[model samples]
Target chain A: MDTTQLLKGVLDLAVLAVVADEDGYGYDVVRRLRAAGIEEVGDASVYGTLRRLYSSGALTSYVVPSDEGPHRKYYGINAQGRAMLGAQRKDWDEFAGTMARLLGTEGGA
Target chain B: MSIVDDAIAQDVRTYAAQVRAALADLGPEHVDDLTDGLEANLADALADDRRAHRGTLADEFGAPADYAAELRAAAGLAPGSGGQRTGGAVDRALRQLVGSVRDIEGTTLARLRATRWFPGVEDLLVALRPAWWVLRGWALAHLLLQMVGAEQGAFWLPSSSGGWVLLLLAVVASAQWGRGEWRTGPRWGRVLRFASGVLALAAAILLLTLPQAHRDDVARAQGWGDRPVEDGVVVAGERAFNLFVYDADGRPVEGAQVFDQAGRPVTTEPYGGDRWRQQEYWPDGAGDPLFHVGVPGPNGETRWNVFPLHSVPGWAWADSGAPLDVTDEDVRGEVLAPSWPFAAAAAVVPWRTGPEATLPAPAGASTPGATPSAEAVPPSDAPPATDGSAVPEPEPAVP
Candidate 1:
């Protein structure tokens, strides 16, 4: 199954989690997501997700002038983003638990 | 060396532009936001450990529109096809127009460069840009003049009050561009800049195709174009023929007004009423339905044979009972009569004589005993007197 569909639902969560720990620019977020083993994440998708989240007030951003290239737009999760992330995490954990029981993973050797 | 570098620079620029176009209609701010650092990022990627990447850069990005769609979806924005941005139909259409113009200019320029073996054409075209700028201003002024109701179809620069106004305005516009910048305030400044570009393009087209081929009243008056015989074919440079006018009675009608088939005076010469021109005789009295009188060349003694202009009903009309009606109040004929006399009469409907006919015996031979009978009228419009007699005495014009 193409996890791209699955990843679409969790992208908000994934992007917020990556930036929650430290502010990162668009491509930097992509690099991190790939580093975390989400190989299916497209570079453009990550950039757009960052923009959407920032415009929604879930992420705050500032431009850092660059000597090497274009000034980078760095994004960090704000209080609103953190609050939403906490809520989403709760719902995901509950859903995972129920799925795990149905799939026989609860006590399977 | 620089040409190759320019080609590369142009390639990169074209790619970036394609990307920008894909994002058009999505909203300018949104498009810019997505593409802000894309070029710089691309430069970096290309620089990283060269030789690591294979194939063309386009292969990596795929089609720009598809890429844009992906970005739009990821950003939670609606697709352009969904009509979210269709409210800017004008804006979208303008973008497309500009795009096409740019594409045409680019391809044409590229083709020109590629064919540089044509010897100076490529470099010459590039060097002509400055000249095009000047022409642009001139063309722009002409367009503005016409828009404000200056005469249309006068391809030459304006000589009227409006033309002077255009010159003055151009000087003012140039004056405003000091130190390589426009001095006008922002609003008017932008208007001038845009007009300058549009006018320049328009001027480019005008200069390329309009001016040289365009004929003006001045040129026509100067006998620069199709002229009528009534205009007396103003012998401007090297005159070919001299026209002498006469009445239906073959009496030398000096100063008889010449007219075109439409009855327009070929010249403003005092002979005719109002003239199509002031002084110069229109060449060959350019008009349909003309007439010509032919006298056999030096080969034989022949009187003038008049033929109606073939343009009338056709050449056959000249052979009709009255190939032309010369005796009317006004007969407009433009013709190249054969044996075109350097000095001859302009009588209507010159008479035709068979090729075997010889000139009438010289009229000076007439004696009282001959009684110049009923056959005295010459069969042709040419007065029988080859010696330039004032008139032909009889119907046959000869005994």
Candidate 2:
């Protein structure tokens, strides 16, 4: 089963979760997502999510010029973003738990 | 940078520009942020020591408009083809036109840079930007002045006409003092400003070349003589072509330039001056009749508007040759026609001086720039009716 559709639904959750732990710029967020094993994550999608969250008052953003590369706009999760991240994490946990049980892999079958 | 690296950098910039063009209708702030991000990523992608020199960033990221669409989506904006497709009917049409034009211009520019047909077009356009920018600035200034009902300009500049003097002054100022910003060395701001200063010079030249009067000034400066024909008449073969001014019948009766049936300027050249058989500009071309004459169009601008000259008449108009034995009827029937394929394809039927006319003998039918020893057909007498037939001479001196 393709995880792309699933990732799209929880992109907001995933972006907030990543930024909640530590602030990151657009490309940095993409790199972090890839490192976290979400290979399907697109760089542009992370950027869009950051912007959307910032516009909705769920994230704080700032610009920092880099000597090594182009200037970056860093996005940090705020109170509202943290709250939404927690709620979505709980929802995803419950859903995943139900799905796992439905699969009946109790003894590593 | 290596040539390949430089080339890739240019391609990247072009891609970024395409993205910018697609997002043009969006507020500048939004567009800027997105483009900035895109550029930063591009720099990282190109500069990071890992990726090999391989496919273009465009191939990886897709086309510019597609990338822009993705960027817009990432920014939580509507899809490019949806609510954000642009405004009303007129707006949509304009956007489509702009999009197509931008795509065409950008792709063609990139592809043509290395081609013989438009070599150096890319660099030339880039260098021409300063002139373009300065002119645009002055034009804006004029528009604003008109809006405020200012009839006179502040300096010697005109409210409407003489903004080029203003542009030249600004370019001179920039070249002189624009380096002040760069005195501190090549920071982003200093380097950018330094680059802009280079355009000021280009702008000055662009301004200088903008008008017909200025073009004439350039010609005079180059000592090509502003106008060659006197009183609109050129005495090529004892008969004159009144090219510039009108005759008594209020028509251009004579000119060194001859037109084909389709009104194409026939080619000609003078043998005495410059390089014999070398093409020269119109107005200046009468002296060297080997080249077709160039003229300013109905608009004051000079386009490549040389009427294609038939090679035979062209040669005759040369200093060493005689006038074509043609009448007013021949001019209407052959030279004034709307197309020239027939005129070009038809056999060299010698102009009829009477009911019985003979084609000029090959020995006497030599082009003006041809050997002077070759006898030329006289203007008044028809060639002797040898064999009572038209002689088919080998066509030469014409492509």
Question: On residues B1-399, what C-alpha lDDT tens digit does candidate 2 reach at each position?
Answer: 689867877777888888888887664445654665776666555665533435777676677887777677766676432222325778557545654564454344434533675534544654564565555455444444445665442222454444555545554544444323323311343354545555455446545655765556566667765444422213555422212222334322222233444444332333212234334332222442333322323333221223322222344343554333333234212222111222222234544566324333345433222224222211112112133223422222222
lDDT of each: 0.55, 0.51
Off by over 4 Å in 1: A105-109, B1-13, B44-54, B81-399
i-RMSD of model 2 (Å, 1 decimal): 14.0
User: In model 2, which runs have C-alpha deviations exceeding 4 angstroms?
Assistant: A105-109, B1-5, B47-54, B80-399
Residue B127 of model 1 has an lDDT of 52
Model 2 CAPRI rating: incorrect
Give the Cα-based TM-score of candidate 2 against the true structure: 0.35
Error of 1 at A108 (Å): 6.0
Q: Hey, what RMSD does candidate 1 come out at? A: 22.9
